[model samples]
Target chain A: MHSQTPTCGSIPPVPARAGIGGKPAHYAELLAARPPLAFVEVHPENYMGEGGPPHAYLEVIAEIYPLSFHGVGMSLGSSGPLDRGHLARWRKLIDRYEPALISEHIAWSRVGEVCLHDLLPLPYTDATLKLVCRHVEEMQLVLGRRILVENPSSYITPKDSAIPEADFMVEVATRTGCGLLLDINNVFVSATNNGFDPRAWLARISGHLVQEIHLAGHATIRSGELELRIDDHGSPVCDDVWDLYRETIARIGPRPTLIEWDTDVPELPVLLGEAARADAAAALSESPHAAVA
Target chain B: MLPLHEFQAAMASYLSSPPGPDVSHHLKSMMRPSLRSVERRLAVYKNNVYARLVDALRDSFPAVERLVGEDFFRYAAVQYVSITPPKSPTLLGYGKDFARFLENFRPRRIFPIFPMSPISSSVTSKPITRQTRFPSASSGASETATACCCIRLPVF
Candidate 1:
């Protein structure tokens, strides 16, 4: 049987700078090189497996750097009850790793036995609000700590969404007492696709509740007259999104930021370069040099 | 006054059968121009959804695409989408059934000689093989000798 550990009472404090998602490919180099960053984020599901190389590498890296557990599964916004087995697996990993931060998306991707494998959007209605709050409460109760909920990028809007997207997020955080991940790329993509100002949307979110930030790449696809920017995460961070990220950090202050690149993964140096860029941006915000400029 | 379920049902229907009668009225109400014009617009969404899923499959299963060529793979993918639409919301987990579908597909059956290979074949030409040989060659030889010695001791 695996040993259980107690969840700490308060949110773990982290450096207000940059981090890279923990991947096995960079395990040795990350340990040996010790890149200049705040912390490392990892998908909790990847470490949910039994004893193997992944766990070994993570063990070594955790010794050197602070860790955050970001979950891609969990389906926290599903209308159905949370998956008991999935929750159990996640709880096990959390107990083992004792990561500083734990997070999941504010969307559902499962119904009954079928797993959609995509971060499906939730309708911004009272009914959905109740459903998601119940799920989040159950998750917190099981893990014994609060999990940050990240906003998702949506392609199509539901016909009967009654509340604004920002209002809905605020309501979830308020009702569930969970912190926000505040993915800037998702904000830019959703606002651009749905005809809304990202800055205004960012303003609506309560800054005090946000605990983490995410930055990533996106691609644009044109269909006749309309242009849609899909959150592909396959290329370099766009200039406008970086500007928005910098601006958001300036308003909200620095949080533990992450650089997520899941598709067409580049070399280790390239990803670290992007993380270094984020570090530079966050530093510039804190730097006395920037105040002079 | 359209309910959310009804709208989703109509979308599912239209995605399954493009320009179907069930969605024509709804599309007209939701979109501008006319019902005919709405048909064109709805077709765009249908294409977008299918294209995204196809590209997703292409990324996950590039070897499958290379074996069948882009045009043929895309045709098969479109058909697959129409027949078995993604029931999950996680786009990353959407293409779980493609490998099984490719196995029995008549079009893919034409290429019977395509071998099962590792994902890193682009860099290395050596084929990976599985073996279950015993660790000790002497033990294997001894077992073989004991079986034949009882029958005949004459041999060079």
Candidate 2:
């Protein structure tokens, strides 16, 4: 029975600047350099285990930079009911970390009792919209905090999907009063695979409801004659994704951007280099001259 | 068009199932028609799901992977994943029964003798002999002991 009150007390929101995903491998180096970052983001699932070096490092990191919790396993959009035990674990983690921004994907990874462990796509329909809103509201009720839901990088569109992806996400945010974590890379990936314009998807999103942004790299695989872009987060943010991020920030007014490199995580400096690029790009986008020109 | 749960169930089955006529039928039924082939689109999710689960197993049992090499390990992992899909939401501590799975894994009996010894040690650093002596006879009790043993023996 974890307490609902935040033990860490009130914390400030993550600033609208660039941050890097907090990887365990880079803990020591990150502590040593103490690079100037707006915030540091981590997947709450990684820290859900018992106390160890993960907690030890996160404790110190949280003190220096505003922390954001990007959860991958909440299965918020599942057809099944929300897992109360998993929600309890999330509650415990939130009580301890008190991340400035908390987020989960608008995708389901579990079916019945089996956890598939991938951000499985959801059918865009009235039923899914209502189910996701209920889950988001339930999550907020448990954590006592409003969370941002992220759009998934999709490959296949279900035949049953009735609404468009952008409209579905906006509806979720609108109904639940939850914010949106707009991943520019995911938009590019899904747009490329599903034959939709990424810019058009962005246009449908309400900028006021967006709280943070994500920029990551993807892998391109040739499937027959068609190319598939996978949001693996394994490489540097490509030029196309950067352009999308710049345009997003320029339009959305600079949310707390994160440079995510999960798979094949590189050294600290390389990640920091990406974060620096995000900062530079955001600065350029925010500049009046660039927007005007 | 399938309902949400029915759609997810079909998608789940397709992700784990081997590519064949059955898979082709499943894809065409559930997926929307597009310029790209349905098989190709479904293959992306299949790769992501299997790769993620296989990587979790690899992380838990590095010694098994080393003894069997990447290709064989992947082959065994795919089989194990098909038989025993993950139940936990988080990947951490997800593949505890993998060492036991390797013991009965039929294709590569040649590599079985080396896996349980070093792999359990690799996972929890506990000696297998010491753990096997404890009273863990309940359901999934053996799996718990084998999954994260507390005893450690040097890998010979």
Best by DockQ: 2
Model 2 chain B lowest lDDT segment of ten: B147-156
Clashing pairs in 1: A116-B88, A116-B89, A116-B90, A117-B90, A117-B91, A118-B89, A118-B90, A118-B91
- Judged by lDDT against the true structure, how good is candidate 2? 0.75
lDDT tens per residue, model 1, A2-87: 12222465535779888887755556567778988788887765565442555767788788888888886787876667889888
Q: Which stretches of candidate 1 lie over 4 Å from their true place?
A: A1-12, A288-293, B1-103, B112-156
What is the Cα-based lDDT of residue A167 in candidate 2? 92
Residue-by-residue lDDT tens digits, candidate 2, A1-293: 21232222466667788899776566666778899999988777767666365677789999899999888788998999998988999999988888898989999988888887778889888888899988988998899888899998888788788999989988888887888999889999989988899999998998998989988888887756878787777789999998888887777788899888765667778988998898887788777787731
- lDDT of model 1, residue B136: 16
User: Where does candidate 2 stray beyond 4 Å?
Assistant: A1-9, B18-24, B110-156
lDDT of 1 by residue, B1-156 (tens): 344334444555565552232446664454323122344334444554555556556655667778778777777777776677655333424556677676666776567665544223221111111111222122121010000000111010
lDDT of each: 0.66, 0.75
Model 1 TM-score is 0.74
Task: Give fnat for candidates 1, 2 and onward, in order.
Answer: 0.05, 0.46
Candidate 1's fnat? 0.05
